[model samples]
Target: MHNVSHGLNDIASILSNPILNTDSYKASHYLQYPPEASAMFSYIESRGGRYGRTLFFGLQMLIKEYLCRPITPAMIDQAKAFFTAHGEPFNEAGWRYIVEQFGGYLPVRIRAVPEGSVVPTHNVLVTVECDDPQVFWLASYLETMLLRVWYPITVATQSWHLRQTIRAALEQSSDDLTQLPFKLHDFGARGVSSAESAAIGGAAHLVSFMGSDTVLGVVAANHYYNETMAAFSVPAAEHSTITSWGRERETDAFRNMLAQFGKPGAIVSVVSDSYDLFAALDVWGTELKQAVLDSGGMLVIRPDSGDPQTIVLQTLRALDASFGSTLNGKGRRVLDNVRVIQGDGVNPESIAAILAAMDEAGFAADNIVFGMGGALLQQINRDTQRFAMKCSAIRLGDDWHDVLKDPVTDAGKRSMKGRLTLLRNRHTGEYRTTTLPLEWDERTAESDWDDALVTVFDSGKLLIDVSLTDIRHRAHAHEG
Candidate 1:
């Protein structure tokens, strides 16, 4: 072995130490990445070797594309050798860590109806199968991925539902839905998990709608939009610093902010509630208008305080009264130039109420934009009213076992056991629920079932090359 290092020293070192026992090395690696890897490995280990190879296999498949240059024979050989040389325990631990990072597998061969599909509870929209019996033990670990996947779907669904409701209300209540010009940004990073998940969740939202504050989310969703999306938002900075005498200073925040952002327009969101929302709007309205018009910007003032609905109404009235005549569009003022964007505690429920009040107050619907955070992307709650996950069937020995866990009441969840298949009506284009033996669940056989849940992933490998855009488009189409 050549001593020449190639930026792989750390990995190489871990692999070469003969005295480095598997458990110790595994523990060390766990310390580096922590809980996820260790926890998964520990769980798999608890089941003994039966699950270790399965776990390793799953992780290998999941990260191979990202980690391996091309998953060539040499690369695979190198990986297996490195892992083996590092000792089985460490190798297993590393594999577990990687799998945990990549997410889990789901049993139902699933082709999701896009990210924003308004999936109903008990609707097996996910196509799954016990296709590969060897990976049966993987079902448990797959739960993690399902949970992760479910969050984005749930959040996106809720947002899409709200958008749908908004659209419907506009039509029914004489409000123009077309007034919502800005994007629907998923600005929940400060409170959500890693940047990736936040961005992913944001991308999922884009499937049902558009707008995101996350750059990563833009990239993820942009792959589908076929256009470059940019993240135009404010920096996280305080204008004043605390001093001895309870002092206050402007510190040229507006000027400095102008310097950085310049003449802002195009979804320009400023946090007015930072100090005093109404007062900030009162003070900034003039400059904000000039800045927007001069810079060709539409100032969107984000009031993240008080009751979102009340604040939105007041802000809308203030902007309208102040700049209404100065601007051309009735409620859309182009002169004084400011739009009230409700954020902070703006969840779906609050949004619904806000929209209702704004309509009741005869507020300009077009003048308001939404900057959703916790409510949209935080996976608030499983509003799985129309959606659900159930065990269709469990295979025992050579035969399949059908088990149903019927909920005693609405509080008690129920599941159906045994191999089952979902059928969709071609004429209605809706999912038709039913159960049948897995052996007869083949769609290629020209089954009477028009809608069949096919396996999207098998043995830890994706069965298709569906893009995020595809998911988004499908979700949007389904919503329509």
Candidate 2:
């Protein structure tokens, strides 16, 4: 069983302390994004893409797993026991308030950028506000829970940047940009920390691409974003399936794949490096050549080991020589009925390097597909994008005060002040955050700038539930 207690800190025991400065109980806290997240990418251009996804994902799970049901007397007793055992006074009044008022509902209002809109650094992706003064700290208390959105958002942004790279390469080398969505496939599910992480990160990748082997990710997209089937995969063979036939019968394994999936226009991938990749290719070119040609399906040759760029180029050259090739309009060689999929050593830099090498080798970008695993999902953290949630404004009684933390030690950690609204410049389409007084009405500020943030959650209900199809369309519409 998954341990829920392992996820939280001891400080969480005091989260509901009503004795925490009686003044703070009545204050309204504002959530804003500060300007320290630009360092996540190597270049500014690479950071441009739609962000703020998985907005309600974490909250929904938190509710179902921890807070949706009624708080029982036994639970309250355990909370008291835990604090007392640690030599701390349990705040009974605070716990009572949480039990009485916070049943199956969060009392905060969330405003955020519509999911999948291109967002720049330092702009507020989301903002939270409390209607009840006593629950002002409620949103802040949920920071640990809400911050889980960072994983999916970062994964989505990384995948989107990779899409841009592949699209640019294809645009320069081939006339068919329609295949851009399937160029990069998600093979990262098994390498992720957990099934949930795979689901979230995998769905994030599908926001830009269509090829994926992660079924859980597609399930996640359907569950969280109202998508039916957001990703796809071809019938393929792994080392186990091929090697089960033994090395001597490898040609039979190759023949079986063609015989089974080799209908008109069927696509199947066979891992070619199980024994000798060169020998496997030779067999496909000689003994299995007639079977491949007569099967009427495209054979995708997969090379799992070796230096990615060099191996892919060598494999492409060998395939061209064996299958024969025709020149496309761009003068790049398009392999006859065979293709290559390089799943090893594929990250952003290596992907760029391989595509460049392929162009130099006179091969069309469409002649190969790229599969990524660990780098796509597990290689990032919250620090990758410098994500944070901070209070920028607080209300005491009838007055509002601008709150900020500007330490001399680190300027990057300094927080923004006052209630914030994200604004999009009409002419340039760039986004920026505007700090406004708590009294400033949004209706008055709507003329000069388009308010990029919309109310997504309010009074325990989801106000905006965007479909994955719409999100994909919005994400790719601005690619030009």
Candidate 3:
């Protein structure tokens, strides 16, 4: 239930999405010169004034498609001092050479958890390593991607945890403890940055979660990756609202709803707050029950006002008494078909609280759902979830030199100086790194330090499949 914090820049207002509106013909010419080049430029476009935290992911995509190889120093030099004069500290020449050497190697290494994994904060959920030292500086420029990718994944992880907590509460609240179909809703798209990021974030949440994301999420995951269509398998659902002062409105809103979506098993969401919630529940309970049964669809009631705990209890009781007669020979109940999704300021903490309340009131876990938005999506990790590019181990003077960044400030922004091996402990299985003198810098340490770099590419060809899902899964496994 702990929330991630954020800073002002992190929560900046979203930017508008339109490029080159200066002139129609000129804009069209600049924006649509060619398919490949135009595609690359969009990576940096400001979508609705907000770019996803990981701006570099878009850059990576651009580079992969257009640059198509490691950029070489020769390429930089050929730019005739434009890159050098820009005051970029990178050895423009050396980087160009390294790129030419292994640009196709796809030098970046990303170690991250699978799309679905419950991970704690401060856990090294992802570790990205670049293969070439000459291009190590490139890592710095790409911090945006690292941030963007990790943030959503982390948020998704926490969201899933919240869902699990809700399920637990509903089950314990019920008399029979039957599991319920909790449809997870994705309402974070508009609040998120871009179409691409929203889609990606939504898809990341959907792989092991559920939601409605921007279009590209489906296109990228399914059309491009050939993965299953990412969506909740549930049929249809509903919406509702509640208010302060306890006025509840059970407006035959259900009738109008059925007129649109229609019938049994059809999904309907009713906001139950216009007057006294309990009174509204007692009055409308029978009608709502009859409508759901008659339509062959399920009813989804949403409580947007009042203490979720108290409101849920009152409504549950009213619902139980009205629909109690529908329980059949096996003691199974018809209310089993209904879902109570709680929202409006629901977050991980509030979710935990409501869950505890449901348990106190004997409501089944599977009988409810949750729609998490602002409180959930807007949360940011503020512990300085940092992963900086460091040259810990480098080849020098026929041996690798160990490097260390003396502490610069309270930020702990020091870089490693010598050649180091990031090794996995065989016995404890935790991460440990060792510094080695450059002279003995072989493929690995003689003392058996595991070589962190695997042959991702060889002879201009990829040596491994580099499956994103598989890699994500491996990273998730490392989370303790």
Candidate 4:
């Protein structure tokens, strides 16, 4: 191997190393655990936040990307040197032991609810435990990384709730629910913090919809989740493209968009709010009205700056004046070949509000869709679902000790205790978190019938493989 090292004054590696993926404080955690603690049992849960449920996802992506590979001696050395200089303790001997004894595969087992399963919060979403007595700290050590899954889970949950809102509106106003999946589009790639954030959060949104402009998210779903094309986008124009033409020639830019992309039976979106949004609407409502009709493709009008609900109501009325509307079977007006896409300031509340206002105005839900950006991907935090991973139980010699924390200050911060497993009722389908030995050993008859948890990873090997298609099917199963 070529020694491409820059000398001691060298910049730290920007490349991803499993050793450096965590908070620096985590490097000293091995020494902090109980000395006699032979093994740790920890579980992840969403304590409840913006939503009551979470769409558990992105775990397979994490496992395939980080844990499947073996740890290298070089990694240990690099981490040691970095931590020594950074004023933190590094568990060198423990990491070396992992390399020597386990050939670098982390001696831990991970079990989680099957990916794409939407379960209520305050339940076990994932559990981790050390597979070796020597690596008792492995479970918590992985917390800093494992908890990152909350990003995708929360995104998926938000997206799923958006889907429910859209579906309800469609049911009330439209003749069919076929267009529901594409109703909430992902316009969030550039709005997020990182490319990986775009990728994972984008993929999470794809759980409920097929409409997205976030290309890397489509690639991630294809690469990590075995999808051919998990999401899709139509030819659309941004503000830069429309504004590139001088302000006086706004209609010409809108005309050029149609001339370029409006093929028979195709759909295209154009951002119309670069200048005077209503003025642009006036131009489209008259000068380009005949051109839009003759093109034989759908023209999605996007209003980029306004109160989404109010703007949607006004846009629908403007489009109705331009193009005649026919009432659907449900007695709501559906605009012919023209639709509005409200992309500004969209979130769960705004989406529901827009749909409700549409219902009040006798407009069909099919007359509009939403394009969500920051709110869909980057606007949330771990506390959006109040996610936490805590050691609930530990093994010391022959006895298992149950552990828990009930903070008197905040009852919401209280935690559960046990070597835990989640079980579902065969008849009611409600889930319950129960202790292992009592449930798995003594009450095996009941749990064996309906254990909701599945072991997906064991001893650094992925035991069960899942695909995007299967996950999508499971996610949509409850809908019909």
Candidate 5:
């Protein structure tokens, strides 16, 4: 038995040892395949779910974080000890082979669609296969780790849909869409599973919007994708800060928030519903009215509790009544001094519904932005997008055979066979992002298809590097 007092990091230097990074059964998979099997092929895809299209992201981060490191004798020894205690067979010989022949680097090649391209569901996002004949199982052995792409992919997809939702609203109700990127702010760092999840998922949200409070995510984007300052945030007040002032001093809290962050043309968000939201609105419009007007900044009022659609409209009306408003040149009402940001229960559906309600009520989409917490990061999973990585083909001796799984229980779960090549759909090209597949290695200069899948990694080294700036640009390429 392992000692309970020992920390997880003490059990093993998990990051350095790729051996302990997978399912327990994976340790025994080396012996399960036919002895003659010389190579294996696998592919990852979104089987189809909430949205028909998925914005590819975070593969560069994954490659740098996991696959780039070479294996060592120490990792093999640690893995053997772990599998022994857990009653699983160890692949000592295979690990030794990798260390000796490949200098501890994984003898596998990976092909992935560029990180920012949007591809339809039921299509290939990444493919993997062994580079060395003897280590064929290495391709699929990495499944447990490689399949983690689903999280960032799912988050990016959800964020993109939200972007589209906001864009539609802005087009109909605002004179310009310049504010679309900052419309949905990320307040989800503290609400995610771990720091790593916060970083990955937070960076995913930045693919569409530039607002985030997850500092680690910005750091990660710079470290992994070579982009510094991937997102931005401003001084914001939380419930603790507002409520800590005591109920009687609520107005004092609002005043302090402005004094600290309300510089010229700046923006600060303050939670305004600690006591009575309507009452707070009254104070802002009357006693503190001139203070706000002379502050030379935007006061973004946040309402923490209520039905979002109703509260957002209510908040907008109150702010407008106090500061007054003006119709822009395009004829939509714009708030003069203050704006509302609905942070409670702000999901994609609720955001769309809120905007639709505002449009119906003669309120411009610019009158309010949104701050999403749980819904932005933690409220999703692999099944949210039906993500899967399945073995599609295998090489035995000199022969290649198509591999697949077709369950009688659910045809939707049927897997792919042979190998795949991701190519641009030349006929329906928009932003050069539309994708279609062909049999493996069929792409040619003679044909019109531009190969979207790239050899991003191989032999434990990063072959192709794409930066976060490049990814963000590609992700929004369709916006033009």
Candidate 6:
């Protein structure tokens, strides 16, 4: 966290000066897609299905971070001095206009698929346009900031995929599917690159799952999306909490957790692998079973190391054998009062494997949960889903020009052209991107697809302020 604060200060001066942006963007005003380009429309899309195409997240946060702060004269002076010292030419005129006319707020309109929609790959998720002709370059300039949305969007999509995977397993193994929302927990705050990254990426996970240890993510959801207490965590103990009691009194350590939080319905997670996991489980199943059952609260035993699928299956069998089990409506055995959580080596792939194995073992999915750290928030990159933002269309003085990059080297890198509209194929409910005129009206035309993109940001104001609850609801709707 300290590292992040210092890093933010390092770039604070440059970010404050909007003109200190990329050099190629400086020529964008004059040298555009074509000589007559007046308005440039760019869109963001995912080209792969590794994480699915749920996107356009973190827009509100991007707006608040870059657009809300006013560019000041002091910032301009600092930019001028910094650029001149480095023998670089600064866009003085551009910065002046932005400071005077735009009042530091971006003069751009952003249309996006509502956050949490399960969009398909190779479909546009967001479109950006600038109303001011002189600031047509602003569309792509904002891209520099807005493109950061890829991180959160990717994280959200990955988490959503995990949710779908869990839901499917729960449907197969558990009669009660309501616990799906809490199946995957976020333990990635400490594993991410920075505090801001943790907040954004963690909140993205919350869009699908409700379990999280990242308090800043909850704060971010509340601050950016009007959410209140968007995610939750349980009272838990780490290895230190157990080891500090010594191996001789290990049972005392476990007993202390129950004594601290033993109320009915209270849940506390204990990292049971601090010493010998099997030995600890043996003691828990034998010496501590009556105390745990009498306490009325559920105890979540955490296995933090070893092959996740194998360890989880072993833990489930051991727990069920000792704690006893009852068959759910699905005829799958669920633990009587205790559950297992595999926090180690738990990624989307491993999660699927674990669930499948558990199902095959005749154990209910509701008997266990997963805690993911780096894989949940930090392991992925923009290329994981092949996300890209490209200018699809440019309006000349009196004509609209379609623009695209058709690189012969890599066909996969080819981009879409012309004014793009994201539409959902009604029959399949799959999102598709189409090239159409800017003035094309859907009201007067009959089409097989419904427009999926909506105005989210228009000229510095946020048009849509979706709450976290609403987003969760939307993400879950597709499960039906």
Which candidate number has the best lDDT?
4
lDDT tens digits by residue: candidate 5, 1-480: 453332233654755568788989998998999888998989999999999999999888888988888888877877777788789999899899999998999989999988988998888889998846777898888999999999999999999989999999898889879999899998898999999999999888888988888888777887887886788888889999999999999999999988888888999888889889999999999988888878899999999898998888898889889899889765778899788888899998899899999988888898898899999999999999999999998888888788999999999999888866576756565223222234334555335666678889989889989888888889888784
Rate residue 457 of model 5 by lDDT.
Answer: 91
- Report, for every candidate in turn, its global Cα lDDT versus the true structure: 0.47, 0.72, 0.44, 0.88, 0.86, 0.81
At residue 288, what lDDT does model 4 achieve? Answer: 95
Error at 48, model 5, angstroms: 0.6
Ranking by TM-score: 4, 5, 6, 2, 1, 3
Q: TM-score for each prediction?
A: 0.66, 0.84, 0.62, 0.95, 0.95, 0.92
Local accuracy of candidate 2 as per-residue lDDT tens digits, 182-251: 9999999899999878888888888889999988888888777777778889999999989999989998
Tens digits of per-residue lDDT, candidate 6, 99-207, equal 7897766677888888878777888888998756666777786666677788988998888878888989988888887888899999998999999998899888888
Cα displacement (angstroms), candidate 2, residue 472, comes to 1.1
Query: Over the stretch 90-160, how does candidate 3's per-residue lDDT look in tens digits?
Result: 23354445556665243554433222333233223333344454443333334443345544454545545
Q: Select the stronger candidate by TM-score from 5 and 6.
A: 5
Candidate 4 colliding pairs: none
Span of ten consecutive residues with least summed lDDT in model 3: 38-47
List the candidate numbers ranked by lDDT, top first. 4, 5, 6, 2, 1, 3
TM-score of 4: 0.95
**Residue 303 of model 1, lDDT score:** 70
Q: Model 4 over residues 1-103: C-alpha lDDT tens digits?
A: 1223412233344245677778889889988877788888999999989898888899999999889988888777767777887799989989999999989
How many pairs collide in each candidate, listed in order?
25, 0, 62, 0, 1, 0
Better candidate by TM-score, 2 or 5: 5
